[model samples]
Structure formats: C-alpha cells, structure tokens
Target: MSVRTIAVKYGVHRGTIPTFVLRSGGKLRSTGLNNERRASAAILYRDGHTLQEVADRLGIDPKTVRNAVVAEGISPRPRGRRPMAI
Candidate 1:
C-alpha cells in the first residue's frame, strides 16, 4: 500500500509512514534526496557544465556540487587559472 493511502486511511501524517514502516521492519523504497541531487549534479557536470554553472542551475553552492561530483566517484576539475595558448 502507498504511504498516501495509509496516511488517508489512518489519519497519520504521510511523512511519518516511512518511519513507521521501518520500525516495523518493512523496507521503504525510494531514492534519497541527497542521492537524487548528487545524480543531477553529476549529470550536469558530465554534460560539460562547470561546477559553478551546475550549482547556479541547481541553486546550490559550487562547493556542494564539487562534493557531490566527488562522492559519485567522479574526479573534480582542477581549480585556479586556466592555461592560455601561446
């Protein structure tokens, strides 16, 4: 049964259903917010957007985007001055 259904049937808050199920040893299936954010950041990065660009697009800090990329096993691009062609 869905959390919304349970919530409606029992007059319980929908957010608390996951906790109740877990306490009862039932597994709750869903992609976590952090994981979803990380995946989104990674995709934007992979699509050639810079960390700051991705951060701006996602309304998060560049440092957070960098951390998300790193946590996803992706190597972050080096910071500092870009080399100019001679």
Candidate 2:
C-alpha cells in the first residue's frame, strides 16, 4: 500500500509510514528494552495515568507514550474534554 493509504489505515502520520516501512526491511529491529519500555508505558496508562503523566514518568514525550500505547493494541483516551452540546 502507498504511504498515504497505510497512514490512513493505521491512523498515523504519513511521514511516519515511510520510516516504518524502512524499518520493516530489517535495517533495524526492535529490542527487548524497547518492548519493556512500551509495556511499562502501557501499564502506567492502564493504571489511570494520563499519557502526559506516563511520558513524564518515563522521560519520554507524550507522543511517544501514545504511540507505544497504540502499538500495544490499546486505544488511548482522547486528550481533551468533551464538547458542550449546542
């Protein structure tokens, strides 16, 4: 699939798709340490911490926490408050 298609299907930025495709070519592999970190982030999120909280605790960016959560097949809560009814 094209990068745009993959991005839309996966709900990621189009810019990220190329990097993912390139990484899939075996030029780089995910390490156990990375998996552990992602797991840790997921756990923190599951335990009721917000993404920003998890990121702060992990010393990573909120976007990193969000991506890690999504990579683990978990849907993260929306970031902001609900809109008021008209």
Judging by TM-score against the true structure, name the best candidate: 2
Could you give me the TM-score of model 1 versus the true structure?
0.53
Pairs clashing in candidate 1?
Answer: none
Cα lDDT tens digits for candidate 2, 1-86: 56678789989999897687788883533422398899999888877788888899999888889899898888887776222445
Score residue 53 of candidate 2 by CA lDDT: 88
TM per candidate comes to 0.53, 0.55
The positional error of residue 11 in candidate 1, measured at the CA in angstroms, is 45
C-alpha lDDT (0 to 100) for residue 47 of candidate 2 = 74
lDDT of each: 0.83, 0.79
- Model 2 scores a TM of 0.55
lDDT of 1: 0.83
Q: Ten-residue segment with the worst summed lDDT in candidate 1? A: 77-86
Candidate 2 segments exceeding 4 Å error: 1-33, 81-86
* Candidate 1 structure quality by residue, lDDT tens digits, 4-82: 9999999999999999899999998653238888999988886778888889999988888988888888887677523
Q: Candidate 2: count the clashes.
A: 0
